[model samples]
Structure formats: C-alpha cells, structure tokens
Target: MIIESNDERGSVNRSALRRLTGIDAASFAERHWGTTPKFTRSAELSGSFEDLMTVDAVDELISERGVRTPFVRMAKDGRLLEKNKFTGSGGFGAEITDQVDSAAVLSAFAAGNTLVLQGLHRLWPPLIAFTGELVRELGHPVQVNSYVTPAASQGFSPHYDVHDVFVVQIAGSKRWTIHSPVHRHPLNNQPWSDRRAAVERHADDSPELDIVLEPGDVLYLPRGWIHSAQALGETTVHLTIGVASFNDYDIAHHTLGALQEVEGLRAPLPAGWDPTDSEAVLPHVRRVLGDMRRALDELDRDPEALQRITERIASRYDELVRPEPVRPLRSVAQMGALRGQDSIRLRDGVIARVVRTPESAAVVLRDKTVSMPPQCADALELLLGGSPCRLDSLPGLDTDDAVVVGRRLVREGIAVMAGE
Candidate 1:
C-alpha cells in the first residue's frame, strides 16, 4: 500500500507509537509503557491498520509470495504442527522443498490451526516502513508477527514474551485474557519457558483484563505479562508489534564489559582456591569488587569510555533494527547521471553520524564508514540535514568537487537523489 506522501510520512513517523496507543508521548511514558497493559478501542486510535495488512494480504502471502518454512507456521491445540504438514517442494526448476504449500495451509486452517506469519516487518513492505518508524521513535528494535486464527481456536497457551508488544487488530475479533506477570520486566534471554509452571498456574487466576479485540483496536502489553487469545466467531488476524527495549542492565553490561581492559580486574583468581567454598572465594571476590569499583570511577572520569559505551549501544541497536533499504540499481544510475545542479539528500531512514577529526571526517553507517577529507565536513553536514539541496550549493567544495562528493555519497548508500 502507498502509506502516505512525503510530508505525511514524516508526520506519521514522528507520532507512530502515539497513534497506536491513542495517547501523547508523556502520557504513554508515564502510565502505559513498561508498567501495565493498555487497551484502546477503534474510536481511540487515529485509524485502522488496514493499510498494513489484510485478509487478502494474508492469502497473497501464503499463495503467491513463495513463503517458506518458519515464516509460515501452524499451531493447533497449543502444539506446533510439523513443517511437513504445511510445506512441500516446489516443482520443476524451482526445487526448494521447504516452501509453504497453499493447499496444505488451507487444509490445516480448515482443521482449526492458527497461521503465524513471522517477521512480516522484514518481509512486508508496508510493515517494513511502519516498523522502521517505530524503531526510530521508540529507540527499541521492533518486529511484527501476525496470528491468523480459525474460528473459536487458540494459537498458543498462556505465556509471556521477553519483548513488549502492541497488538493491532487488523480484522475480525479475538478475545484476550491477560494476567499480571509472575516475573516482571523479563530480559531478552528470559523466555516464558524458564517459568512455565508459574505461567500455567497464573493462567488459572482471575485475569487483570479480559476483552474482545476488534478491527482498529490496539492492546499494549509489557514484557512478562501472561496472556492468551482465541478467535471469536470468525477468522481473526492481528499484528504483534514486539519492541525489545534496552535496559539499565544492558548499560551495566556494556560498561563493565569495557572494564576488561583493566589489568587489575583481569588478573587470575588466587591460584587453586575452591570455587565452591564461600570463605575461600570471599577474598578474591572482595579484591575483584574493589578493582571494579576503581575501574568504574576511572571510567566515570574518562570521556573515551563513555563514547565506547555509546558506540556499543548503537552497535547493538544497528544489529537488531535494519535501516530502510536502498534501491541499488537506481542508486547506481543516479550516481552515473549525477550533476552539480541535481538535488540530493541523505536517504530516508539511513542511520548516519558525521564525526570529524583534525584531518578527516567520516560518516559512520551500519556496514562501513565512509571517510572524507576534513574540507568536506560542512558539505556532509548539509547533505545529512534532512532537506535536499542542489549539489553545487554544498559548502566547502567547488561545483565539480560537489558532484564528486554527491556521487560518492549515493554510491555508498549514505544519500540518494532527491524525491527517491
């Protein structure tokens, strides 16, 4: 779907999360985010998510999109059906064996299995753009998975996710029963399986909230909340927009991990002490704690340490959330056809930062860093400033040199021709 115009896209990007929750940023941060569940009706949200996905879209993805295993999965009665139940080999020249068989999917869905379309944020175009906006707004990596359940069926048993979620109901209705978390604010590594017994026990308790979600409805669920849903009366589809937030523990992990460079902290424990004996390990633990305390003090006073911590955080963010993709063929053509009079700007959704040193400036990207002479800093700054500018109008370079820089930027995927 054509989501919006450029101006509308910018406006939408800025308020994507707010639009979902029907609350301002401050209200969402103070009340709903990371603390409790929020249920908003169709009248509350800005609009429906029909543009993102639909029943027809689900059919297209299954029958025409060449979907493979893992991306297309089925579950019935809380147990995942084997891939062979819904997948088969493509015939003739295309001989991949794990592709989703539309006929099999039909049969399974008719038998009351829920169809799970995983990683739609990466596979679906509309979601790719929408998910990128959410990532930028939340500073938390976001993912989208759709659950299409047959009438009166459940996808999975009551469980919790390590990542927070905003459930956007796309079509039909699903009744959800949510209970308070047994273990709150779980980290990414802490899956519900770790506390399966507790989760199952909690499912029997009175629910904190029980509601039927219809089209245009949204439900925000913080990580570790025990919840389950069942389609009511008709086939149901909903997008699980998962947000993996960075936590204080992550900060400590990165900061302390950087302390490995300290010789004192890295020293081996006293030769042959028994690790199981508390008294034998106490002194070494005390010494290591003292060293860490001193190292932390040193790090607090060091700007370089702070910078490394920031970089590590950014690196992790980059690893989880991909920026908008560039059209390679179009970029190459634009590069070859470039001229001083052409307009160019940093590509939308490209995460870049310009860092300058005495002799050179570099644009840091996820994959590679593009370095340029210090003289190009001003030009790079203007180009990355969101607004398109005539190549010849760039500061610090002649018209021909500006063209050279423009082509280089396009070639490196840092910038694109204006209107692209």
Candidate 2:
C-alpha cells in the first residue's frame, strides 16, 4: 500500500483511501457509499493493522488498565452481560462502581462469550494513530472497537449499524453473512430493530454475501447493511472502524442555525392558534415558507455563509482529538527563547485553518484564533503547512516579524518546538 502526504492541500493522499478500501475514494463515494457492501481480499492487509491491536493487548487492557463497564462489555447469544457480571471494585480502596473484573471476563470468555472493547482508538496509541489517519483521509470522525469472539461464539445478532464500518480481520477467522438493507441509508436513530420483520424475511430468503474472513482481510459495510459474524474454530479479533458520514440532514441542520439570524425566522406564531383553523395558521405558515425559501437562496449565494457551515462540520472533529498536555514551564521558556534558526511545527492533533478576509488574515486553532496583518499570510501558510520550519525560512516575514508570529503560535499551544 502506498501512503503519501499531499503538502499543498494539507490532506492525505487520495491513493491511501484507495489502498485501504481496494477502490478509489471517488468511485466508492459515487457507487457504494450508503448503498452496498464490499468485500476486498488483501494479503498485505497485515501491515496496515498489525500494530494497531492484538489479543494480548486486549487482555492487558482488561486485566491491568482499570478499564470500566461501557468500555468493556461481554455478550452471549446476542444479549449483553450486566455490569456486575464482569466488574468488581478496584484495589487500594477504589470505588466498586465500574472497574473490570478480569477473572470474570476470562471466565465468561471461556464459557463462549464475546468480549468487546469499545473506543480502543482512545485507549490504544497504535489505534489512535490508525484512526487519526483515517479521519484525515475521510474527513469524518472515525471510532474503533475490537471484537474478541471465542471459538464458536457470536457477539451481536444480525443487525446493522447506522454508520458505515470497515472491518479488519487481525487474527483468526470468522464467517460473515450479509444481507441487503431493508431500509437503505438509514439514519442514526433508525436501527435494524425498527424493521426487524423485513430484515428477518430478507435474511431468510437469501443473503447477498456469505464468506469467511481470515487474517488480513477487510470488509466494508455501509450503513443499513444487515450482517452478522461468528468465530470459526478459533478465537477471532477484528477492528471495526466506524465512519460517521456527514449527510445532507447535517448540512440542513447546521444551515438552519445560520437561517436563525434572518429576522423573519424568529417571529412568533399567533397566540391561541387552533390546529383545526387552517385559515388562521395559513398566513403564518406562508410567511415562514417564504422565509425558508429566501434563506436557502441567500445561503447558496453567500460564500461566507457556506464557509460557516463547513467550519461547523469540521469542528466536530475537535472532540475526537486529544491535545498534548501543556508543559507550562518548558513552553514558556521556549516561547521566550525563540531564535531565527529554531525549528517549530504545529502540535500533534492541533487543528488549524487559515481564514482570509479583505483587511486581515487569521489562523484559527481549536482553542483560539490569532489574527495577524495581511503581510503575514505567507508566514501563516508555512506555519500551518504540517511540516517543521525555522523562523528564518518563512517566505514573507522578516526575521523579527517571523519570530514574533512564531512565538505567539507557540505560546498559544498551537505550535511547539520541534525536536524538543
């Protein structure tokens, strides 16, 4: 697999997405996104996920890490075990509320239960890196969960997730049975249980795909695709990378916030309105309808309003990122000692975007936005370029001005001293 960085766009190489899915990103978006299931066989898949997780890692997390209830769950015959079944008080007089009971979990596993480790991307560094790359490539929030099913055991019933998922088989093998979605492109609130009868009838009639996934295989199931898997002969461990797609509803939802600024949208309805009186409510309804149409047209024409919607969607990623811990003393001294030759780079997981206006340019970070004179636009570009650079190397700014700007960024935790 080839993974290259696109420095110009500050985006991951499109080929990386192709390599991961065995299909071009554009093609997948056009043909398969929220529409179908795809199974791609790859022997080289081990390199992509081998370091992300392992059975030993799962065992260690459950036994050592003070993992808790929701993070670690055990299920059998499609039913989840109660928290007390596999949780106990921690040592050192810790509270008994939610700590994992490793022994109980192990016992359950031995008795044919499937152990599920949720949010491994948050707990495991390797998975964090993997999921971060996916997030950058897909421009969507990515979450990871690990399913460790004992031999001849299954975790959940034949159901569908509202979000799309990439299942990577890391160890052992499992037989997967997939059926066409009963409700195509279902939203987050729509689960398979809502259409259980239709799903069951379709599943019974004929499954679209039934195959055994071995180590180094990948399966991509879009939202609403019904599927189930069971361990085959040996234990199975697979990573499910869930992608929360940004749908049209999300766009309208965010756009409505912008619409609220229009005066007509805020007018209250007439008091004591009767549902039976269409004539009484018709005027208000017609006015609001006209407002909605005008708002939509204005939003389509205004570039700034469109940009706001994009920023609103981008900000969701902020919650998934874990910022570097602030080192007050070291960071303070580093800011104070900025030299022309000192190298610096944006801190890991520090998201920054450049906003240009007629008067000035601003560098927007998660916690704050720094506005600077238009003269510093080139320097700001280099600083947010996802690469290390010395203060003296910025294109437009003089040495003194470069130092000033770099110091401000470093002081604000947006950038950090490289090689420190």
Candidate 3:
C-alpha cells in the first residue's frame, strides 16, 4: 500500500510506512512482517496524531467483557513471564492446564496482581477487530495477542514477547525497558516456552530505552525488545499487538499441510513394513522414499505460497489485540473499483495480498504457500493481503477482469471457495 520510508521526522502515518531503526515500524514490518523481529520507540517511529480505534461503535465492540475464560498456570500472574512455558512444569510451580483462559483475566487482575494472559481473542470479538484494524491501518497483516497487568503485591520478572509488538498504553502508565533486539530478527512466532531461552542467550545485548508510557502513547519493540514492567500506581492496562512472521522455518511447516492433501503421499506404506525392521530394508524402498522427496520439490514450485503463508501468519498476530480499528478501505474503494464482498473476514486474524481468481469462486490463502482448488482463489485474493492488482469492475465474478482478479484471490485466502 505504498508505505513511506526514510522520513525525516523519524515517524510515520498509517498511509506511508516510515522506517527508523528504533522507529522502524513500517520499513521493518514490510521487510520482515512475518519473519524478522523489529521494534520502534516514539522518537524512532513517531506515529501521527491520529486517534486509532476511537470510534465509539468499534471501541465498545472490542472492549474487555471480563476474562471470559479461566487463567492457567502460565497466566497465574498478570504478566506472562517465567511461567510462559507450554510444556514442562517450571520451578516457579506453574503448570499448564487445558482450562480456557478468559478474554481478560479479571479475577487475577481484580486483586491488582501480576498475571499471564493466554489467547484473549478466543473469548472476545472487539479485541480481535481492534487488532485487525491496526493491521489494516499499518497497511500490513498482523495478529493480536494482548497483555494487561495490574499493580499488585508482585511485579513481573524481566521477559520478552514471542512476536513483534506494538504496545498501546491504553488505561494506565506502564514502564518498559525497551531493550534492543536479542537476535536481529528473533522469531516471536516461536513457542512461548522457547522465548525465555532465546532472551537469555541475548540477555547480554538487552540494552534499555527506559520509557514510561501513558494512555494513547505507543511503544514498539522489534520482536526481541528486552523489557519488563510494573503498574504506575495500583494497576496498568495495555494492549500488546504482535505480528507473528513466517520465515524459512514457517515455509518448512507448509509442506506438512500439502502432504495432508496429496493422496499418493497420504497412502500407507506397504503392509507389515516397519522401521523396527530396518535391517530388512530394500534399495527400491529407499528409492521410493526419494520419490516422495521429489514430490515435495514439485510442490515448492510456486513462489507465492511462502509469502502467503508468512503473511497469513503475520495477520493472525495482528487481529488479536485491543479495540478494533476501522480501515478507510471504503475511501480506497471510492478511489477505485472497490466493491464489498460478503466473505468471512478472519475474526482476530490477519491476511495480506488477497485477490480474485478466474475460473472458480474459491479463495486461496497463500497460493504461493500451498496448493488449493481453483474456485476458492478469487475471494481469497480480495480478502487476504492487498492483491497488488488493478482494481476492476466488481459487478459479480463473471466478467473477464473479474476472472483475473478472482484467480489472484484464490491464491491468497480472501474467499471461502475456489475462484471460477
């Protein structure tokens, strides 16, 4: 969407993405939107005087309806810190349970204590919309994972988020260390359990910016900003909007999705064949396995799927945050041939470069990411990421231009079915 880069003020508006090292939200986001970790401070990436998510209609819609779910061991504290692991029990005596964490951790927060929040969007819709709006305003797809902490008997220990974060100090004053990126682009998309270890490895580089943020103030940390916080007074509430990027590791995961679809690939091995009988293996069997490997090579032909997969991932991280923001897409439509589609917009999800397809009405998510039927592509192209295509007549999907646009959507995840 034509993000403005290399500006003098060291900040940016939603229209043009500005890039400042400490203020590099738009530039860095465009580059590693789904891969590398990036962070920006007020001076670095000074956002304009725009009031994001200010509409009463939307603000009310995405407000916290109290913690709709239960707090797990990891979220026992207001901030998700030491107990962030999703696997083994920690020395802190925290354990993971299957109980659903609420949209907002009210019970734990009501007492004004530190706590860990797990998946706020699952129980809330407004938060999801807020996150989605932020992504759209930023002109990028991002997921929204939120964090709200109350000042209590204890404070959160030093830690980092598992994704690139845009912190909106919504309700109270919260302090942050605003550390440097541990790894130039640490994957916050990595499991919560693994984040601390990554941070520990880079703890030596955890330089601090030391800033206190109040409501309406925004703080950004490229995925690995080593920071810690405490309530300014009794409690502090903030929204941490994260964008989980997809890197090579993510590309590696798409293969698993493709394998699930390929029939010959899914077929079971010959009867009685077992790895336990390794001593009885045959050369032909080995060659057959090589053939399967070749199948993957064929699957990787599309250059777009990887980008699509990464963007989808990035958007999910965007749609999970605080109050939903409204994109002026309606204005964009007026400028071009924008027509509304009654498609399912991912609730609390982010997608990028969605376009319409030619033949089927299918919507594809990351056509470059994986294979899909044709009909579903069009809806996806329009619905996912900005298709980067010429906006054409939107009088249904029967015309020639419609077909071309529809095909693009099938490739992206903008629609429900294939493009025709």
Candidate 4:
C-alpha cells in the first residue's frame, strides 16, 4: 500500500500514522502494540499496496545474492538464533528457485539448511522507509526490515522476539501458530539467543492460535509471543517490520541510560537523606523517581530534539543498508556485517554512533531518504537494508566516515557487507 501523507508537503504526519491502525498511536500503544497487535485481513491491501516491491523484484535479489555472498544457514541445532537460517519441516538446504525464479535454488542446498533472506529492510528501502516515516509521524520509533524464505524456510525455532513485528506477505504463503507469551512483557532475559531455550522450558498455554497467511496478508505479533512459522507451499516471501519503541519500561531504561549523560540527573542524593534511615530514603527515593518520570514526560517537549532523535534513530536503520554487497565474498569472515533498520533518536544535534562512511550520507528524515554514493548503484539498498558497504571499507574513496560507518555496519549484521 502507498501510505504517504496528503498534506501536500510530501512529509509524513503523526496523525496519519495513528490513522493507519484506525486509532492514534498513543491509543494503539495503550490498547495494542504492547497489549496485543491488532490483526486485519486487509492490512496489506488497505494503505499502499500498489507501490510496494514485487515478487519479481525479490527474484532479482536471489540472482543478485549469488554475486555478493554465500547462502549461509539461518538456523542451528533445532534452535534458531537471530542470526541462523530457517526452513520447513523438510529441514534445511532446500532449493526453491523453481518457485522463485529461473530455476529452483532450494533444491541445491542441503536437507536442513536454509538462507536467512536477511536484510529485506535494506533491500527494499522505499517501502520500509515509507512505512517508517509514517510510524515516526506517530512518534513511535520504527525499525525498517525485510525477509524472503524459499520452500525450505529461513528458520528460527519456536521462540519469541525482542520487539513487536508487523509482517506483510509479499509472495507465497506461510503458516503461523502463536502461543500466548509466557511473559508478554518479557524483561528481555539474558541475551536474545538464550531466550529460545528458556522459553522452551516454560510450558505453553492451552489453545495455540494458528494463522494461514497468503500473499498480501499481514499479521501483527506483539513481542514475546512464542510463535513458529513455516513456508506453506512452493515458496514463501515476506517482510517483517520490527518497531523499536519507547515503552514505559523502555522509557525507564532509556532514562536510566540517559542519566549518565544528563548531568543534573547524576548529582548525589539529598544532603540530609540517610541511606540507613528508611524514613529519609522514602521521600528521597520518591523524588528521584519523580525526577526520572518528569525527564521522560518531556519526550515531546522540545519538538526539534524529539524530531532529531527520531531522525537519528531512523537514520540508523539505513546505516548498514545496500542492496548487493559492494565486494564479492573472499571468505566467510569477509562478509563483515549486515546493518540497517538500526535506530537512533537524533535530538539536540547529539550525534550518536551510526554507520560511519567515507561517502557521507545526507539523510532526509523529514523526506524519508539518505543520499547514497553515486558509484554504488546498490548503495540505496545497502544503506537502507543494513548491508555492509565497500566505499567506506574498500579504500580510496572520500573520507573516514565511510570507513567508520562500514566498520560499524559490518559489526552489526543488519546486512551483508563483506570486506575485501
């Protein structure tokens, strides 16, 4: 769906973003996102289907990947890490080009091996960024991302996610059966990799809900829901857009992190308050909590800073984006990192560490874009999808931002940017 704003200024609108769900974002967050992601059969059809990327476009990606990186595994040990590959019950390494393009590539891979189809957010930047700009309008931080699994499946074991996800099916269909989360607001335990086993150890609730999704369908699975999916027929392709947001918990955590930087916040406790005295500590602690509350209450006070942070974070998603890797794979380690859909709130002109590139990307938050290097035709995909870039790491071009951005991108794994 083509969901741009109608203000005639070519800019995204917060109200419009809220309207996407037929409710304000705040109201949605209060009622959904955190509580439950409202599902709609026509979500993919409602707003902007016409201009979204196509199946043919995805076919080109499979072709292009051959020139860039190896088809690595996205799953391991019957468990799926965020970095592992996924495939169907048929197991991994299934060739599916017949269902995808000129020939079946899935047939070529091993039985249980499947590709990650990673970095769709960068691969199809316009669609994701458009969605992101809309989300930003509503004041919710959004992560632009993507995915396309063949018949085998780019697998992740039955598990939970770190953030909320809205998946739009672009090609074939898939089956989803989500068990209610053991803990909806799971206080992000251990690392994301460890969550799988921990979650598996928890007994699932009765009545797992199953969803059969076809092309053009969309599903919203709130974070922490224990869910599993597999390609339904032939091949399956889709886009999973994860939203990195500031929830009550997130705000408290971020505020805690911000305290290190916001000096007045770090001043020692009340002069007379004694840690040994509960009476004194009570009021002092109350005041401290109130101060923290007030600091976050001001998230929107300085609209410019709010907007800047939004832009900076939004720009982070593009840092590791590039469609095709700028360099061919010389080794498994050469594919530095895949980064994109990263997030930074660029408020107060406070520049955070995002992708540093020799070719400085003039990102337009208000307009939903980044200036790409001219020589890099795939630069847009790389920057927006989180693929590693060569201009910054390949030497001989521009400056240090390129190298820094490239290095950071390679480290993040948002996209595949292999180093020569």
Q: How high is each candidate's TM-score?
A: 0.93, 0.83, 0.49, 0.50
How do the residues 1-420 of candidate 3 rate in per-residue lDDT, one tens digit apiece?
Answer: 424433453322222233223434555556645443344444544442223332242223223222222332334333543322332322244343332233333344565545434454443455443444444445444544444555533355556665666666655577776555545556545433466676656555645566777665666566555666666774555556665544565556655565555577667777876666766567547866787687677667856655555565554444443323233443233324423332223322323333444533433232234333454455345444432333343433444545445444333333322111
Compose the digit string of candidate 4's lDDT tens values, residues 12-52. 32333433354444555567756675655655233533345
Which candidate wins on lDDT?
Answer: 1
Give the Å shift of residue 185 in candidate 3.
6.2
Separately for all candidates shown, the number of backbone clashes (residues 3 or more apart, or on different chains) is: 0, 0, 107, 72
lDDT of 2 at 61: 95
TM-score of 2: 0.83
lDDT of 1 by residue, 254-331 (tens): 998899889877667777779999988898789788888988999999998899898888787778877678889878
Total clashes for model 1: 0
Q: Report the C-alpha lDDT of model 2 over 94-133, residue by residue, as the tens digit.
A: 8767899889988988998888899887788777666766
Model 1: lowest-lDDT 10 consecutive positions:
1-10
- Per-residue error for 375 in candidate 2, Å, reads 7.0
Question: lDDT (CA) for every model shown?
Answer: 0.88, 0.80, 0.46, 0.50
TM-score order of candidates, top first: 1, 2, 4, 3
> Which is the leading candidate under TM-score?
1
Which prediction has more favorable lDDT, 1 or 3? 1
* Stretches > 4 Å off in candidate 1: 1-14, 355-359
